[model samples]
Target: MQPLIDEARTFPARAAAHGVNLGPHTTSATPQAMFIACSDAHVVPALITGSRPGDLYELRTYGGRISPYTEHEPTSEAQTIEHAVDVLCVTDIIVCGHSRCGVIDALHPDSEAAPFHLAAGHWHTLMQFDALSAYPCVQARLSDRTLRLHAWFYDIDAGTTARYDPRASTFLPL
Candidate 1:
């Protein structure tokens, strides 16, 4: 805890160096892409894409799951999509899932059941299904037509990536 607290103390220094290190991003930020990735600390969009600040609008989820866009009620997924498309006018939206995901394994029938925090349980419920389907809930959400949604598999071990081809229903080397 002390170590983390010590790291937190560097915030001001980092903030002060923002203009020096991130000077190019000093202007208004209007990202051209919306990156929906896993919340895992291992996966950082800026680091992975070699992008600096304000280049990408990111939404990180436990399983990098995408909720379908709907007009019924105000939802975080809906709001994020609307803002990214209408407000930011982002051209592309990427949904990336990482390898060896505990969340995905938890949803697997063969995997052992373990207690998760309330938020994790709720997020899992969004992907839980009553019937056996080839694709997960997130895949189903990407099937929507309004926005061009892409699913990617990021392998941390091999440092390789694969993109899901919905038409082929497979992950191809990227």
Candidate 2:
């Protein structure tokens, strides 16, 4: 409560002095690209990608993991992707993954066999299976000439960004 109050008081002053608009009234008209990023507090999609409010149409996931492309499930990520592509018509779609992700850590082979929550356990299990064999499973759904799907690994500790290029079979620094 104290921290929130402090920030509320200080942010406006800082923004005003810096000539930055801190108000929430401005509306974003249109977005150029669709950014898919993790919901980790450490992972700020706009800050990481240097995007402004209206520049990117962002979709955040637990670990930025997308399940197999399926439109059957009502709340499936497929709907989000389809909307971003077909509806929003975003020219680029970036799927960003970070190192030491909690979701990934949870899905690690050594993690507990049975999670406390069944739904969470099932989701992590699905991610583990997809991440282990990321080659074809991830590639099959994301491989498209018109819409580019980028798999990026952001290393928080090292402050490095690696893009996976399946053709070259390497993680090149960006």
Candidate 3:
């Protein structure tokens, strides 16, 4: 915690030297995508995608799970998606799952350290995309061809990424 605090103390100075003009960005931020990933510290969307500040609107959840939309149930996940879609007008939505995910293993103990666990991770990514489709904001944007939903898999060991190809019903090299 002290290290983090020390870094925060110098952030103002270092950020200024980073050469990004933050003045204009102070008013409104228009990010390129809505990145939905697990809360796991290893699954860093920004570092994985080489995105800087204001490049991605991130929503992190346990296992990156998004609840199925139900009008009666108001969830922060849904609200985040609505804001990212309606207000930010982000064109892309990425659901990323990582290798050897503890959440995935905990949820499915039978598949622990097995091939099924790996498959489950990929399945989970696509499931999030399906969940997002249930959101009216996402559906509206998708219907108008203004939004695209993507499912990604990140191998922690190899540091390689794969994207789901709905046509092939499989993950392919990104």
Candidate 4:
């Protein structure tokens, strides 16, 4: 914690040295995409995507699970998804799951998938997509073919990402 505090204290100088100017990052954000990942600290959307400050709007959930959208009783996840789709008008949505995640293990303890492997995380990633698609805003954008949804798996140990290919019905290296 002390190290983190020290890093934060020196971030301004480091950011300036790295040519990261914060002046243009206004309060309003128009991100290119909405990235949903696990709440695990190891899975950082910005770092994983090499994204600048506001390039990605992020929503994190345990095991990257998205609660099904209930029209009569909307959840915070639904509201955030609505804002990203309808207000921000983001063109893409990505749901990412990472290896070595305890969330996945707890969600499916009976599964035969090797513990903490990317394959073990596949089920939940797809489940999140299924829930995300149930959102009205996502449905509208998808119906108009103006928005794209992607499921990705990250190997924590290897520092590599894989994207699910609908055509192949398999996860492929990205």
Each candidate's clash count: 0, 0, 0, 0
For lDDT, the strongest prediction is: 3
- Clashing residue pairs in candidate 3 are none
Specify the highest-TM-score model's number.
3
Residue 107 CA displacement from its true place in model 2, Å: 3.9
Q: Which stretches of candidate 4 lie over 4 Å from their true place?
A: 24-29, 107-117
Q: Write the per-residue lDDT of candidate 3 for residues 1-174, one digit (tens) a residue.
A: 999999999887887898655565654668999999999888889889998789999999988899888788769998899899999899999999998888788867873458788788998888888888889989999999999999999998999999999899999999
Tell me each candidate's TM-score.
0.63, 0.65, 0.91, 0.90
Minimal lDDT window, size 10, model 4: 111-120
Q: Is candidate 1 or candidate 4 better by lDDT?
A: 4
Clashing residue pairs in candidate 4, if any? none
Error of 3 at 139 (Å): 1.0
Q: Residue 73 of model 3: what lDDT?
A: 79
Candidate 1, superposed: residue stretches over 4 Å from native: 1-28, 109-148, 166-169
- Tens digits of lDDT, candidate 4, 1-174: 999999999998998998777776665668989999989988999999999777999999888878898889988988888999998899999999888778767656765656535556887688788889888889999999999999999988899999999899888999
Question: For model 1, how many clashes?
Answer: 0
lDDT of 2: 0.62
Compose the digit string of candidate 2's lDDT tens values, residues 1-174: 999899988986876886766566344355677777678888777777877546788778787766664435534566666666666666666666776677756656454643433334334433533542343323443565445556566767687677666687555787
**Sort by TM-score, best first: what order?**
3, 4, 2, 1
| Residue-wise C-alpha lDDT for candidate 1, range 1-174, written one tens digit per residue | 998898789865775676525345544567867887778888878777767567788987776665554447655855665677667766567767676566756665353443333234333432321111122333343455444555566766677777766677566787
lDDT of each: 0.60, 0.62, 0.88, 0.87
TM-score of 4: 0.90
